[model samples]
Structure formats: C-alpha cells, structure tokens
Target: MTDAILRMRGITKSFPAVKALQDVNLEVARGEIHAICGENGAGKSTLMKVLSGVHPYGDYSGEIEFDGEPCRFSGIRDSERRGIVIIHQELALSPYLSIAENIYLGNERRGRFGLIDWNRTNADAAALLERVGLRENPVTPAMDLGVGKQQLVEIAKALSKEVRLLILDEPTAALNDADSRHLLDLLRGLRADGITCVIISHKLNEIRSIADSTTILRDGRTIETLDMHGDGVSEDRIISGMVGRELGHRYPERVHDVGAEVFRIEDWTVHSPTQRDRVVVDGAALTLRRGEVVGLAGLMGAGRTELAMSVFGRSWGARIGGRVFKNGEEIRIRTVGDAIAHGLAYATEDRKTYGLNLIESITRNVSAAGLGKLAKAGWVNDNREYEVAERFRREMNIKAPSVLAPAGELSGGNQQKVVLSKWMFTDADVLILDEPTRGIDVGAKYEIYSIINTLAEQGRAVLVISSELPELIGICDRVYAMAAGRITGEVSRADATPERLMQYMTQTEEASP
Candidate 1:
C-alpha cells in the first residue's frame, strides 16, 4: 500500500438525475495489473472518467494522489501530462489516417521548423508497433487493419505519451481468442517495463488469470476489492460482488415447447459484395420451428453473420439467391422493408453502427422500425409512440432515467435493449439475433437470454448467431455449426459439446445438415 502509485479517495460524481458514484475509493500499486469488475450501469466507467479527467476536476468531488503528490487534473491533457492515459472501449482513431499519423495524432513529432517530421514519426511508430507485437506497415491506413490490430495501435499511441498508468476499457471485447491472448501478453510485457495498468473488463476469466488485484463495484458504490493472489477468489465470488446476489445459474432454464416448422431458408447462396465472383455463403440452408430457439455457431469469417444478413433481405451480398419460406409458403424479401413486411427481423452484431441511432432518444429509436403501425394516414402519433416505448422499457427492464434519454448515454447492455425494443415493436414472427450478448456482463447476458426465452415462448422463431459455443448449448434447442461458408454439422442440445463443435468448425468439407 505504501508503494501505491494512484489513490482515489471518497470520489463522488453525479449527473442531472442520477448519482453515478458515491464515496468510491480505489488504490493501485506500482507496476501491477489491476482490474475493475462491475455490471453495466454499475458506475465502473463513470469512476474511470473521473480519474482520467473526462469529468474534469471541479466537476466531481474527490481526492486524487499520484506518486505521493496531490493531483488535480483539469482535463485529459492535464492527466496525460502526468503520464496517465485512458483507452476507451470505442477506439478513437481516424480511419483515413495512416498508422503512424494516428499514433502521434495530437502529440506529434516536430522538426526544427515546428512542422510534423514524417520520417521521425514513422520510425518511432514502427518501433512502438514492434513493441506491441504488430507487424503491420506504419504507412498503412488504420481502417485497413482489423479490430485487434486497431487495439494495438491504440496502445502504441498510449506508449507514445510515455504513459505511467494505462487504463483499458473492455480491451478484448471485440477480439478473437488468439488476438485476445496476444493483447494480454502485451499487457504483461508492459507491466514488466514498470508500467501500471487498471483494466475494466467483464471477462472474469481474463481478470483472474492476469490481474494482481481486483476492485468490485455495484449500483454506484464500492463493494470490495479482492486480492487475486489470495485464497477463495473464484469467478462466482466476483459475480456475486458485482451483482449483489448469488447467481446459482449463469443461464436461466426454459421449458422447450417447440412447435411446427415456421421458417426455412433453402439453397441460400451469396457472393462477396466487393468481389463479385467470390462466394461468401455457399448453399447454406436451415429450418426454424415455431416457439423454438436455434443457434448458428462458427469461427471468425465462417460466414455466420453474412448468411444472416443476406437472408434478412440481401443486405450484405451480391448475386444473392435464396428462397425464404414462412408457414410453408415462399416469401419474397429483397429489401429491409420487404423482410419486415414478411414478419422477419435481423438484429445486427455491431449495435453502435447498424442498430441504434445513438444521437436519437430511446423512444424515437424504439419506434423507428414500426412507425407505420403508429401512424394514421400521413401523420404519426407521437403519443402512441411514447406509450409503446414506455411499455417496452418497462417490459425489457431497460435501465434509464427516462425514455427521452439519448441511446448514446446508456451502457452497452441498455443500448442493446433499445435495439431489441426497436425490432420488437414490429411484432416480427422471426427474430435473428446476431451476437446479442457480446460485450455485456454476466448479469446482463442472463437478462438477454431470459428475453430470448420470452420471445420463444410467445411462439416466435428465433435464430441466434454466436461465437461462444457454451452460450449456444445453454440456450438453443438445436445448434448448427458453419465452416467455410457451409453448414458443417447440426446437433441437438443433448449431443452438443465444445469439442464436437470445434471439430465441425474446423472441417474442410461441409457436413450434411
């Protein structure tokens, strides 16, 4: 404790209607990896904002000490000057800019004339990239790299500032397993170099493996901080602290009341949108029964998402050919509107980009897809829209002060709820959920699974696309694995296992459906 590099005492922050944090305390030792664990809307991000000066000094009440010195940061720049940097969940990189340019964006390398020194900048960036284990060219555009590489770029940028304390928010939320392992190794390397890291993550297993100590928060208050190296610190212990309850079951159970076949896709084929001749989904087919929950499992680039989007309305492919049937009758769905008209809905995986309008109110976003139902003649009923949105908010347990709150203001889980509410308003008979619980805490994931069960019980057919095999096994009546753009294997709940699914996912030849 005497060697603590950062100490935040009695930190209290409040917004217009919500007291986000109250009397919160945190301490991080030098050159150690610390983790913050909490559910969505549990004040984890809010506390970090106060630390990084995103909320500023006078905006909150707190006592911050850095390196045995009282610190009062007025802005992010002030905090950065003291070697503190925060990398938010959403990477803030200019896509059009080169990797070197993005790295030294604000803190640029200058020559004698006070202009940017391109040669020195690229060379320095290349060295940082090597340190972060990325082998990409410094001149390459940031947008050209995948999400995992972009994360490395953000870290390289932080390193450029000679950071002492590096804060990462859900660093591995979008990464594949291999990429996630690489990032974790990089964090360990940084720790060895005498750098302190405070990570906010929902991946408890990662925290248990890497973190030296962990602090738990719930409902805008500090719960407790546990020593990872100490005894009796289990994943369930962390979950209980974060949710304020003993979660006996990570996934809720629902009685399987599957009915007759209600939806079918036959001979579905789609070519890449940019490369016209390349097939992304090759002759994929599946069937869904009424009041049933089906899962689609695959590795990255296995065409799971592509198949869903193409089936939704040819939304992401060229040369799309498919026959979609509802209630044993063929239905034409060439556009999003056509898909909706045919009682089909597809929720995208990237909720921020393709799902909700972050700038719009929750009510507006919820009513966006089904305004036709709330409209009379040429005029839309605003009152009806509000009522319907409020109904969904209550029913879905969306945590927000009011329906008028902007979608961007809510947490990742709440934003996803808004996305589901938007589609639910359409009263679609078939719901295609793509990564419905990605980047959310265990508690929020349970709630989402419960919602899916509710949808199935209402006689709606649900198709879920996921990367997690256990989730599919836990919630689906049947799971189908895809490999190389084809259905590789199909198994009922009783026959599903991670090993069997991986065998199917790695198959070179497609298996019979």
Candidate 2:
C-alpha cells in the first residue's frame, strides 16, 4: 500500500438538534480506491462534504492534512484548486450546455484578446472524452445523452480540473448493470494512472470488486477500516461492521396467510409518449394477493416502472390499454385521485422528484396522500394533520428533530420512509413500491424490509420492483421477472436465485424480433 495522501483527524460536525459527525477519522493512501460505508444519516456524506470543503473549515472542527501539508479549505473551489474534485450523486452538469462547454464551464480556454477559444476547447474535450471511454461528439448537448454517458461526462469534467483525489458519491445508484461495470472498469483505469479515489456507495458487491480499503461508520462514528485485498474480507463481515451487529438472515421472518387476489391487471399495453408507435409496456399482466409480497425484477428500461405508472392512474405513456380489477370487479382509474380512491398507491422510485415535496415539512408530506381523512368540511384540520404525521414519524423511526423538519433535510432512507408513511396514511389495500430500497445502506435496507413484512402481516398486498435480484429473493414470497416490456417468468421464493432470475431477465431480449 502507498503512503497516506489524505488524513482527517478528530472531525466533528453538528446541525440543529443533531450531531452529524463526531470524532470521525479517515486516512486514504495515494493511488488507491477507498470506500466509505455506512447507513443513511450515519455521516458518510457529511464527512465527504467536510473533506471537499462543502462544509467549509470554520463550520466544522477537524484537522486535515493533504500531501503532508496542513490545509484548510474555505469552499469547494478552494479544495478543487488543490487537485481535489467531488462528483455528487446528483450529476451537476447543465443540461442546456454542450459537452465541451460543460467540461470547461467556469474554467474555459482563452485565445487572443481574452475571447473564448471554441476550437481548442472542443479538441481538448474530445481527448478527455476518449480517455473516459465516451465516444460522443464534443458538440453534443448534455441533455441528449443517456444517464450512463452523462456519468462519463461528469468524470471527463473532473479530469478537466487535473484532479488528484477524486470522490464519487453513489456513482452507480442510477446506472444499469452494463453501465455500472463499465464505470468500475473506468475507475480501475483511473487508479492505474495514479489518481486516488474515494467512493461512497450502497452497492457492497461493487465495493468488494473495486475498493482497496473500506472505512465503516455507524451513527456518525468510525467503527473500523478493513483491507479488501489483504484481509480477505467478506460482505457479511462488512455488513456487520456497518450495522454494529451480525445479520444472520437478510430478510425478517414473516407469518401471514395470502388471501384471495386483491388486485389484478390484464392485457396492459402502453405506447411511448413521444414516439406514439413504440411500445414501452407490451401486454403485461400481473396479480397480487392480500398479505403477499411480490417482486418485479428486471434490468433498467425493462418497463417495470412504466407498467406500474400506467396502471396506477395512466400517468405514463400515450396510448395505454389496460384493464385493472379490484376484488374481481373491473375498475377504471382515469386520474391519480381515482387511483387513490380505489385503494391503489404507488411509491415512486425517484423519491427526490416524484415521491415527496422536499420543500414541505414532514407533517404536510405525510398527510398529502390522504388529506380527505383529516379534513373537516373541506377545511384541513391542522391539529389532526400534526397528530397523524407525528404518529407515522414515530412509527417509521424517522431520524429528525421533529415532524416540522423539511423532508429534503433527511437522508435517503428517511426520505423513503416518509414516502411509505404517506402511502400508508392513505390506507391503500394494494401498494406498489418501485425500487423501494435503491440507494439505502444495508442497515436501512433491513429496516425497510421489516416495514414491508409488517405491511404484509397487516393483510395489505405489496408489489415491489427492484433491480437487485438478491433483494427480491430476500423480501418477496414470489418473484416475477420482466424483459423487453413483458413478463418473462415467475418463481417462488424456494426456487429463486440470482442466476435463475437473471436468465429470465435476458430470455426475452435474446429472443426479441
């Protein structure tokens, strides 16, 4: 291993009524990829912010040393000036700008007389794009690229700064399997070029494959750091360290009888909203029984989410043709309000955008889906709303100062819980959770699983859509695999495995016309 390139000693940060980090210590060796693992709100992001100067120097107490020199960063620009760059989970590129413009956005090339140099800038951008394995034209607009290509643009932008220490926060959270593998390979190439990296991710498998060492944190405190190569570490051992306990079983035990089919969809077909003739969801059909936890597994763009959204309230696609049946009687859900009235609720995958109103307090967001239950004579009862929100907040174990806290301030896990709480408040009989545990830590995943089990035990039908096959096998009783906008196969929990599910996921793609 190389010598330590960055060291943060006795770092501490606090917010109002919350100590985000306390006595946190981190050390990263030069030319190595170090991972930071922790549950949501466990200070992983906070620590990174402190390092990248997002928290600034005076806002937190810490001793930072970079390349044997004591350094204090007053802002992100200050840190970037010293060869440090951070790419947040949300990509920071401007959609309207071209690739070359985004790469040299604030830091641009100048020709004679201090004017912009477009030719040299595009040529430099093309070279950087080639280095990052992105083949798109430098003049292509950022909005025209896919998520995977956009990620490459971010990395190219980072390289534009002559970055020495690169930090990636959940880089693969939004990528598909192929894109994820490509990104990992690119990280390896970066490491070969002698650039040290710090990656924050919930995907343990990716960490095991790419990281050299991992630092485990729990509740704002550093627990332990393990050498991935030398120690021969297993994922379970890392999970134990992050959660402070051994998880013998990935899923909680559930005891509930699956009753009659509570919800059913038949001959569902949704065409592309823009293309009109392109079919996004093709004749998909599914059923969920009361007290049953069913899973929909597929690759990204497999139409799982498209089918759910179309069925919920025709919220997606242009030409949608589907028949939904509740209690064996056909129902027409023409709008979101109609779907909610019919006891159907959808917990969206993108919680930041579609799930919660981030600017609003927890009280309002929790009661948002079920305002009619708390209204008196068309006037919302303020005290009733507060009481309901507070009850769900406590039940969901939301880590916040109070119910008045903004939904955006909480971590990813907490935000998901709030979304679940909002759906539960609606008293929906059938719940569709899309990528319910996508970006949360292992500990938070277990908590969310427990909540799903509790919902099943209460005789509510739950349908989950997830990309991780192991998660489906862990929490679901039955798994349905989708591919190319069709239901490819279904398996019982006793017969399901990652390999089996993956085969089903690709079966239709291989046979596509």
Candidate 3:
C-alpha cells in the first residue's frame, strides 16, 4: 500500500566463468521487511551488493532508484551517506576494540578541536545496544563476547549510523534460538521505526515469520515475490521457487534398515575445560544402529556439540567423565588418533576453524585427516594422495576447477564438501557430522543430503547434529532430542517433527539465574 522505497531493474552481472545474474527485478515497499530467498550462489548476495554499493555503479548492469530519485553508487561510502548499511554474513569487528569503540569506529562523537569524546561514545553505544535488545556493557571488548552477542553489536553499529535501509545476510546462521527470536523481534521494532530492510536467509521459517514479502532467486534469476499475507505462503512453495523444482521433501530419503547397535554411549559427562565445577554435558546416553542416521537435536549450547566433540576424541571440555562403546565393547578414546583407529570420525561444525585448513588446496585438505592411510612409511605418496583426493572430489561433486583449488576460494557449500571429503577418507564406521550444511545454499544442500543418504546406505552409523529440525527429520532414520545436556526423547523418522524437537529443545531449568 506504501510507495516502493527501493527498486532494482534488469540487474545483470557476470564473473569470468559464470553468468552470476540475469535481468533480475526487485522492489521493497517503504518500512516493510523484504526477504531474498535463494540457495548458495543464487545471486542473492550479488543482488544485495549491487543495491548497497558494494559492487558500485558500472561494475554491474543494473538500474536503481531510491525514494523517486536515481543515484549512482561508486562505493559503500556513497550508499552509506544515504543511510544504507549492509551487514555481511561475516561480522566485521575489531577483536581488540571495545563495543563502544567498534560501534563508533568510523563516526566518533567529537569534542572541541575534533577530539573524540569517550563519555558520549559509551553513552550513545549503550543506547544503541538497548535499542537492539543487547544487555551487554559497552566497555566490554568484542573478543570476549559470543557470536550471538557480536551480532547484536553489529546491529547497534548500524543503528549508530541512523540507518534508513538495512541489509542482513544470513544474520542468524550462527545464533541460538533465543538469540534468533530476539533478533527478529528487534528487526520488527526497527521496521516500526520506518526503516526498510532486505534480509537474505536460507531459513524459510524465519523468512515467513518476519518478511512482508519474499523474493526467491535461483541461479541468479529472480523468481516470483510472494505476499506474506497470501494463502500459498508456505515452505514448500518458497523452496520450489528458489530451486525451480519440486522439493518432495526437504531431506533426501534414506532406505536403510536399522541394524545391530554399533555405537553406544552410557553415563557420559564432560566438564568445562576451564571454570572448575561446571558441567557441560551430564548423564547422556545414546545408541546407534548400523546403517542408521541418528540426529542430535537441541538448541545451541544445549550440549549437543559438546557431547559429540567429547565423545569423538575427548577433544572438547575438561574433566571428562564418559564411557563410549563400540559393538557393546567399551573403548578408550583418549585422543583423536585413538578415535580414528577405532572407526570414529567427527566433522566439526566450524569448517573454517576446526574443520579444514582454509589456506590449503582441496586435495591436501581432503587427505589431511587420514594422511597415514595415504602415506607409506611416514612419507606421503604424492601420487596416491592425488588419486584419493581426485576420487573424492569427483565422488562428492565438489565444484571447483580442480582438486588443487584453494579451499578458501570455494563457496560455503564447497568448503563443506571438502570437510566431508576429509572425514570420508578416514574409513570410519561412525561419522559424526555437526551442522554439515549450516551456511550452504539449496543446490549444494541437495548434494550434501544425497551424500549423507549414501553413507547411511553403506551401513555406516551416522550421528548428525543439526539446529534445523526439518533437516534432522528429513535425513535421519531416528532423532534424539536433548535439553540441558541430557537426552530427553527419541523420535522415529516417521513421527519426527520440528514441533516435537522444539519441545525438548525448549525444556529447561525452572530455577536458574
């Protein structure tokens, strides 16, 4: 009903080898939340870049209008000057800077003679934090905060600019449910203040919750934009639009019959590596049958990652008190080396940090986890390594020019494939995948799902940990729900639902600070 605040027409962009966009059109009504939905490499980011001046004028073929006026953006500053701010998927904060300092990095409050006023900076930062629903003190250094908190800091920084148009790319990819819900509420508050927003997210549920309209992009082409208040505004339709195909199910179907119990955990507990007398995981127990994909479902920090990591190699937390069993025989997994030898491999959730060597080539990264297998007498057989890496690269359908492509150069989906390739070569009977497709796109997600289904069909006991309930239910034969570091319930795949998992994910102590 309101005049369109932002209009983009005939947006076409190209990279050297790829035609990134093709005559895309988009419009956002003033003060309404507009969502861009696409699988990875869907030109969602590229489109946002064009709008925010990240690509600037002439670099891409696009026409843009703001508030009935045509403008050319040479750079980000040009757009920022008009109250347009973009928050990238990766947060851009100085680790050493205080929250106040980071928020006011470019535009500091000035006193006489252009001197910085520390008092006004902190006070204003606190006000911005309050506006964004962050309770942390402004004086705290950025490094000390968790990722969810850092995201709030980013929002406060945007508020400091008196922003009129805000762009958030995968804002909740790294947040817990509570933080995610809080952030969505904050966005609603910002909308109430007449700020136009464009959100790029893979989470359709979140998009349905907050958006006034949704635009689906597939391979850089804009599909139909759906009205949020319309009758057909559902997940299946949005996914269909994004991928240009019917997604029968969000997860690939697995046909493996649950066999004999191959992996078991009993009376498992892990203490915090630091901070004495703090329990991270407590009294957890599970059983995994051969050829079954079992999901670990829980909210972030509900001890899902902690339990997987500790069980894999005692690699996380301290004062470990857990017993792991293989084929009903208790095994000692004192180290990562021990875990691998005993047919266990854990693909970490944080691919850039604990999962892969980002700077290395894909071939090197693939075989890094199990170099011992690809080497002879402590010397890596280069030819054998190449063969192994190339085999998995083709098998995984990793999108790169060749195996020698730098791991960092690939998109998030490709990076995840490299991580899976690393663990696949380890020859582990039990593979624990933590958030395997967290930041990937839709097309890439299909490939990952197929690979997982293949693993289960091959009789590997797979333990999958996912924050997305649909993902867990779609892929796994059985789902294990956790709350407060304890196994609360297990659901058969036939009955597994987000509503059910959320019940357990939300159950918590009635008397906690």
Best candidate, lDDT: 1
Q: TM-score winner between 2 and 3, please give it.
A: 2
Worst 10 residues of 2 by lDDT: 504-513
Please provide, for model 2 over 278-378, each residue's C-alpha lDDT reduced to its tens digit, 9 standing for 90 to 100.
Answer: 99898888899999999999988889999999888999888899789999999999999999999999999999999999999999999999999999899
**Model 1 residue 49 distance off true place after TM-score fit, in angstroms:** 1.5
List model 3 lDDT by residue over 297-358, tens digit each.
Answer: 98777899999999988999888886888999999999999999999999999999988888
Q: Per-residue lDDT of 211-258 in model 1, one digit per residue for the tens?
A: 999999998899999999999999999999999999999889898999
TM-score computed on alpha carbons, candidate 3: 0.93
Residue pairs whose backbone atoms clash in candidate 3: 39-442, 40-441
Which of 1 and 3 is the better model by TM-score? 1
